[model samples]
Target: MLLLWILLILYAIFLAPGSGRDEIFHALIRGDFADVEPLVVTIFSFLGVFPLLFAAILLPDRRSGSWPFVLLSMGTGAFSLLPYFYLRGRFKGLEKIVTPVWLMRVASSRSFIGIIVALFILSLLPLTGGISLNAYKDAFMHSSLVSVMTVDFLILVPLSWYAMKRFRGIPSPISFIPIIGPALLLWQQRGEKDNERTE
Candidate 1:
């Protein structure tokens, strides 16, 4: 779960500057990027993917220790993977075959439902007021939003697919975590050691 939470934090960071939040602030409130830059947007935009991909790499499977934690992490991370999934389904031939399956899995998961609820709640934040939805609409037109969203889609789709593959009995050597595929390899190694010890 910690791993998954980390991803959510990153997602929030990356989504902030490019998403409706920053756009509305810039347009309506005339908030300057310089003011928000140091604390939030810019740094997050660059490094936000680390925690999520990190957690996903570090996180163990559901059967290992606490299943709920694993589920929660996967769910949250899955939400973070939304952009990736969208793009993969569009560009990758492999995803074209897998998209329906992925979609079905998403529809069945409680985590996906939670994301919807959370986004709804986030919009209600006092600072967000009521115009956030409008801002979100505007965010689509911005170049930053498109760039970030595209990158997000590419990274997340494979991660989600790998997770699904892991669940469905296909053992994958690849981990969804960015800049750290080795973590999954290490986990696999550890899993083998544990199994050998039991044997």
Candidate 2:
């Protein structure tokens, strides 16, 4: 994890300034970047996906008030990933933490995973939609919201995915089937490790 932190800090120092939280905030609240893109408002809405899905994955074995951190992550970006790392030591490992009754109810629902999956598809639709996809390609090259969402998507989702894999003790390497894998893990009532513990 030391190498991960080093790379994180270095990347933030060098690359984040160009497409950091402040830019996302300004573009979101005031339409600061309206003239530059296919659509800034649409981008702003989709931007929240990184945090929302991330929170859903992390909340199962964690305490209450995780929602606020998820809300904050929209502008704070990587700041959200910090708190959970601190909590990992406290609970002896996230997998073994005490899951709340309410959280279990939420996690056990297959429909919830379906919803998250649908939203994910909807979220990326703008970027992946034909002409817009080509436009996003240009923006990605020049570094617009493409860069911001790309960085946030890269950072948060994989972190959540790794945590899920470790928590579930999934040795399958490809534990998740790409888009819905994390959602499935999040929605799991009793994961592989959970089942082992129960037995």
Candidate 3:
């Protein structure tokens, strides 16, 4: 998770003012899609890391029942597992091997269920191509400085703070700032699970 945040934060920093890519996107939003093509190609960078990060964290697990939704969430929103996987791997011996039954169950978890619903709703948005595409194109072009920051905050904060805390285990400002929130959240969740088992 730290690694994930480092890369994302680095990318975000580069997007600050005077950055080439920032200027380029600015141009694209201003009805300069033709010029943005070469730059838009850079989106593949995010796409590449997306799948690897998702698979690394998602491929291993042992929670029982309804696991497919977990997988659906990973494939659609790969970063979700960053916290949980790192923490769990640390305490539980990586080679212990999560059972198939458990994996299915986690995939079907209530939390995961809600994510699936959101993903499906987002899929219906017209951003990919056609009229909706124009809407996104317009927003990026006309959006205010505050709007962009809001987007960045939404992406960076939840994953680093709340999601990390709820799903992974965030303990302090250091780890939280570093995007190790996932690892922190995982530690807490595992402890809770253990306590439940004991009870």
What are the per-residue Cα lDDT tens digits for candidate 2 across 168-188?
Answer: 454444433444566655556
Better of 1 and 2 by lDDT: 2
Model 1 C-alpha lDDT per residue in residues 42-158, reported as the tens digit of each score: 222323333333233323332222222223434343443433333433545432233233444443343443443344234234343223444434544453543344344455546
Among residues 3 or more apart in sequence or in different chains, the pairs in candidate 1 whose N, CA or C atoms overlap within 3 Å are 7-52, 83-153, 84-153
Instruction: State the lDDT of candidate 3 residue by residue for 95-134, as single tens digits.
Output: 4544475543553243443443344334333224434445
The best candidate by lDDT is 2
- Residue 51 miss distance in model 1 (angstroms): 4.5
State residue 158's C-alpha deviation in candidate 1, in Å. 5.7
Q: After best superposition, candidate 3 residue 14: deviation in angstroms? A: 30
Give the range of the ten consecutive residues with the poorest summed lDDT in model 1: 61-70
Error of 2 at 151 (Å): 2.3
Instruction: Report the error of model 3 at residue 95, Å.
Output: 21
In terms of TM-score, which candidate is strongest?
A: 2
Q: Looking at model 3, report the run of 10 residues with the lowest lDDT sum.
A: 39-48
